[model samples]
Target: RPIFWVGNERTTDHIHSILTESEPWFEFDTSRLEYINRIKFWRYLLGNESFDADYWLTRVENDFE
Candidate 1:
């Protein structure tokens, strides 16, 4: 399984646009996509703090907050 790392929501949108506009044959596996917080990962890797798993999950935006 290949992992697609999307830095932020904007990047995700950009990738989607490219895929929709150019590559009609490329099919992405949503299950292998990893959305992570780079800063959090850096801090954790440096032993600054523990890893935050919650931050890595996609934060869905609903019509009603």
Candidate 2:
């Protein structure tokens, strides 16, 4: 499974610490995990357009799948 760490810097750093501590117990490859800032993730999803609830929902669903 792929793990997406999406949050601000502080939260992401906290997540990173947790992941590092638990890496030895993880069954899957840790390399597959990714750390993406929330702002960048939103930018990637929204592109140059304004916010659309349906579009955001659909994009998140499709991308996760």
Candidate 3:
């Protein structure tokens, strides 16, 4: 098996949806610092004013393409 860096959260989430909806041949690294930073970066870009995890979780997911 080969490891692929999916780049950002949206792609990761989209890939995750596909994986869970079917038989997945790939895995993701959603826990890495880079992934975390991408999420935060998006939040920053989107004017994330709420510090609540719940808000951030939804906000990040919504920012996904």
Candidate 4:
């Protein structure tokens, strides 16, 4: 499995140092943090058994507008 590091420059630098010390398919970048967060949010919502469809629908509509 590959480990992706997505964060600001400082954090990426820190993670790069750690990964260099214990390398394991590391890929570091300082971007797409927002996209990654949205992916995680949707994954959590879809995976939850007690998902609130109405709430998320309203939230998504509001987010788009």
Top-scoring candidate (TM-score): 3
Question: Model 1 over residues 1-65: C-alpha lDDT tens digits?
Answer: 12465455433344323222323443454322322344345556778664333433334322355
The pairs that clash in candidate 1 are none
How would you encode candidate 2's per-residue C-alpha lDDT over 1-65 as one tens digit per residue?
23565455333344334323434454544422322233235547669334323243345446542
In angstroms, give how far residue 60 of model 3 lies from its true place.
Answer: 15
- Model 4 poorest ten-residue lDDT run: 14-23
Residue-level lDDT of model 3, residues 1-65, one tens digit each, is 12576455433345223222322442354343344455566558769644233243455556645
TM-score of each: 0.20, 0.19, 0.30, 0.26
Better of 1 and 2 by TM-score: 1
Task: Give me the displacement of residue 11 in model 2, in angstroms.
Answer: 24
Using TM-score as the yardstick, the better of models 2 and 4 is 4
Worst 10 residues of 3 by lDDT: 15-24
Q: What is the lDDT of candidate 2?
A: 0.39
Q: Top lDDT: which candidate number?
A: 3
For candidate 2, give the lDDT of residue 43.
48
Decreasing TM-score order of the candidates: 3, 4, 1, 2
